[model samples]
Target: MLKIFQDLRELPKEEQKRSNIRNIIAGFILIITLLIIMGFTTLGGVNTFFETLRHYSETGELLISLDRARLYEQTFEKENSLNSADKAQQSIDQSIKLANTWNTNKNPP
Candidate 1:
């Protein structure tokens, strides 16, 4: 290997240029191969900022729906106690806030 490397270094300029071009092509091939492998293995699945934002909004909507359902169930319960009504109101309020937050463009602090 050492002898081969020395021989390469002693080659003519034209040969060295060919070697350089070959090495560049090999490097590009290696990078593309690694990217393909990563894609197949899902290792290159980094989320973009927009994707993260979309997921966050989706989660918020789901939570709001669940809260609204709980509030509705509480309102229809047999007891119909004042405490339950208050709790239900709180849940509805939280759900509304969550929905508004999702609709707004401002980032959360």
Candidate 2:
């Protein structure tokens, strides 16, 4: 330990500074490389990550709600008939499935 301290003290101040800078740069490069590798290995998981963020954003939520409203509108727009009733039932089932997904996502195991 004493020899190590002596060697450290013998290192020039400028040399120590340069060494620290190199180490910092190396650490940053390592982090960036790992991130790139992870993104590539995950098959565009990074894109999905950003997309999820966008989907949760205010504008994205508004657009999604609008889409849901449009779906309901279409279901209601159909003429009253057995076929229309079947379509409405399908829509209801889909809505339930979506709701279940939401619940599961919010309360993950």
Candidate 3:
């Protein structure tokens, strides 16, 4: 590499200018290639992050549904109201639907 630089320094002005242009073009190509690779990597990371957020949101909804179902059940047990029983059943059905959705999203075919 040292000898190559020494030879470059001894070249004619016109040859030196051509060599410099070629080096600049090569450097630019390298930088563009790296940028393209990084762009793809960053895009994949962003997609994965959003997917994780969606999964967490679905899980939270499922948990909330289950908690509501439990509360409704306790209310029915205490008051023995048919309305409370119906609401509890609805909450349980919502929880099941949410759970199925979460499972499907987590394991896509």
Candidate 4:
């Protein structure tokens, strides 16, 4: 092993430069992986979940902004509106009500 390292030390300038870059890149990748592992372990899964949720909320807000802009462009007017998820929730609530009604009638209690 010592002889092999000694042979590597005597390599040409370009090869030595490549070796240094290879070592640097490998070390950088390893350090990044270790940091990520430490972060996830220290934050815990629940904390990660909440952090992910926070990111999702930000994305949702961006989507809502785009929708609002599109709506404005189509109408050439501004109007207040609920977010898309709120509209979806309203639809879901209506569907649940209809389902419950059907279930109640079918039972005929």
Question: lDDT per model, in order?
Answer: 0.74, 0.70, 0.94, 0.66
Name the lDDT value of residue 53 in candidate 1.
Answer: 79
The local distance difference test score of model 2 is 0.70
1 or 4, which is superior by lDDT? Answer: 1
Q: lDDT, candidate 4, residue 98?
A: 53
The predicted structure with the larger TM-score, 1 or 4, is 1
Give residue 17's lDDT in candidate 4 (0 to 100). Answer: 93
Model 3 earns a TM-score of 0.81
Candidate 1 local lDDT, 9-108, one digit each (tens): 7778778799999999999999999999988767434555566778687777858676775966667595778777777777777777666766564556
Candidate 4 lDDT trough over 10 residues, lowest sum: 72-81
Q: Is candidate 1 or candidate 3 better by lDDT?
A: 3
Candidate 3, position 13, lDDT: 75
lDDT of 3 by residue, 45-68 (tens): 999999889888898999999999
TM-score of each: 0.43, 0.37, 0.81, 0.32
Candidates ranked by lDDT: 3, 1, 2, 4
TM-score of 2: 0.37
Error of 1 at 100 (Å): 0.4
Compute the lDDT for candidate 3.
0.94
Clash tally, candidates in order: 0, 0, 0, 0
